[model samples]
Target: MALAHILIVEDDAEISGPLERFLRINGLATTAIASAEDAASVLASDEIDLVLLDLMLPGEDGLALCRRLSAANGPRIIMLTALSEPTDRVVGLELGADDYICKPFDLRELLARIRAVLRRPLPAQGRPRQTEAAYRFSGFAFFPQRRFLRSPAGLRVPLTGAEADLLLAFCQHPREVLSRDTLISLTRGEGFAIAVRSVDILVSRLRRKLANDDLAAEIIRTVRSDGYVFQPRVLAE
Candidate 1:
């Protein structure tokens, strides 16, 4: 396997210096940038596989930068934030951050998250050579390659990274009751330490986006004791 190139977008030399050195020593290519603006330029000029973006920066805030980068096909982002609230983490995920590590995090945990994100299959935009596939269900079409959902009326429904991942898992295994743990593992990867409640939030968000009428009659059905299941017949091609 090729060495993964990582961009460290942290302003503090105290943090970036040792982090960059550690990553380099571990057989990864590293670039340390102090500001979001420089990070943008470096990302454009270099082939960076992942970004360790600090939420607090001198110029453009990390959240704004993450929003902009998420809108386009760019490097996978793992936000670095001091905020520990679940809402903050959800917001970051909703804005397209692939993962996040709180400030003063363990280097081992950070390295594990970096590896987990890297191990994930690259999005369609990142892997253009792969054949595109679409799944159709309940008047909605999901283009996994493009990471977008199309309504029955031919309108595009936007989806956050987490929502898209969860929806795809359901569509892939229609009618099967998937437990919270199962869903989390399928969408976020095995050994990912995310709260199961987050799955409930993603499910609610997806239902709001995909269901036109009563959510109870939506394509995704809550299976009381089992978990959740996709009620619609799904066809993939």
Candidate 2:
């Protein structure tokens, strides 16, 4: 399973705070929001897996947000509220909610529902939208899913996980010099200990891969005394 990030859109502090903590403790990332407006902003800027929404929210209600979010291929929505009325559940379902659970619900059951919803197919939508998809640049495409590079002629080139990881960092921050320390922190945790020279070596291997057919000069450039910069503007596909 992918690293799941949950967006909690509940007005109640008592509900949102503990729910966020609990989900985080169970190895999931979370963003807590109190209003539908903030939730919309988060959805646009971040990749969310499932949204845990409270029906009775301040300002625009959860049903409204669910309709707006679910109109296209988007994250899975699971409505949460104290309202157990049949009509409320029906309306929420009609608005494209994947599941609905009454508030004051058990955490275990809630987690199970989240996992179930993530496991099922999103109908014709295929996989949930991810922030890191294929990064295309200078007639080369890098697919993180299969850890392979596609040449301009559509030839498959293999990539090591380490190479792919560093390539992703460069793609994310193109045309900017990234210090060796910064690249280490982006690819590995803060605690990981590797010399700065090793980072240069890794960059060399990846540089050779991008230098396919002897065009590596246009792919990555080294800024003397600084770090490296991805010379191409990447297009995500």
Candidate 3:
């Protein structure tokens, strides 16, 4: 396997310099840019496997950039923020970041996160059968390969990366109640340190997106003390 290419988007040279040197020394290809404006150009020119994005930037903030890049399916984003609040982390995840690390973090931990995110299989890759690429559930079509969701009326619904992962997990195991921990593991992989509350937030977001008057029945039903279940029948194709 080729070494994963990392793009470090940080304004502070003191941080970006060491980060670049450490990742390169650890056998990964890296490119460091100070401003978010330069980010578009670099991403356009290179096949960046992952991005270490700083939350605070000169023009466009990391959250905004994450939203934009994620919509384009450009690269896997791991937000780097000085804010340690749980809400901050949740916001980052909701904005489509694959993962996040608070600033003043250990280099080893960051490296581990990078490897973990890279190890998580992307929707477009590693599927043995092409038929598994799309899933149909209750008039909703989920195309995992393209990370797209189409409503019953043939309208396109935008989904974040985390939302897509969670919805895919539900579609794959419809009518089965998945515990919070199990859902986290299935969507984020093992060793990811995400709170169970985050799962609730994700579920709420998905429910809102999947809601409509025509589809009055709840597609995802809460199991009281347990996690939740995809109530609708799903056909994988």
**Candidate closest to the true structure, highest lDDT:** 3
| Weakest lDDT window of 10 consecutive positions for candidate 2 | 120-129
Off by over 4 Å in 2: 122-237
lDDT of 1: 0.84
In model 2, the Cα lDDT at residue 57 comes to 88
Give the candidates in order of TM-score, highest first.
3, 1, 2
lDDT of 1 by residue, 1-237 (tens): 148999999999999999998888777899999999998789878888889999999989999999988787467789999999999999898788888889998877888788877876556544456667789987889986556899988999977666777888988899899999999788777888988777887888888888775334777788887789889889998
Task: Between candidates 1 and 2, name the one with more favorable TM-score.
Answer: 1
At residue 195, candidate 1 shows an lDDT of 84
TM-score of 1: 0.90
Shift in Å, residue 112, candidate 3: 2.2
Residue 171, candidate 3: Cα error in Å is 1.4
Q: What is the C-alpha lDDT of each candidate?
A: 0.84, 0.78, 0.87
Give the distance in Å from residue 8's predicted Cα in candidate 2 to where it truly belongs. 0.4
Cα deviation at 95, candidate 2, in Å, is 0.7
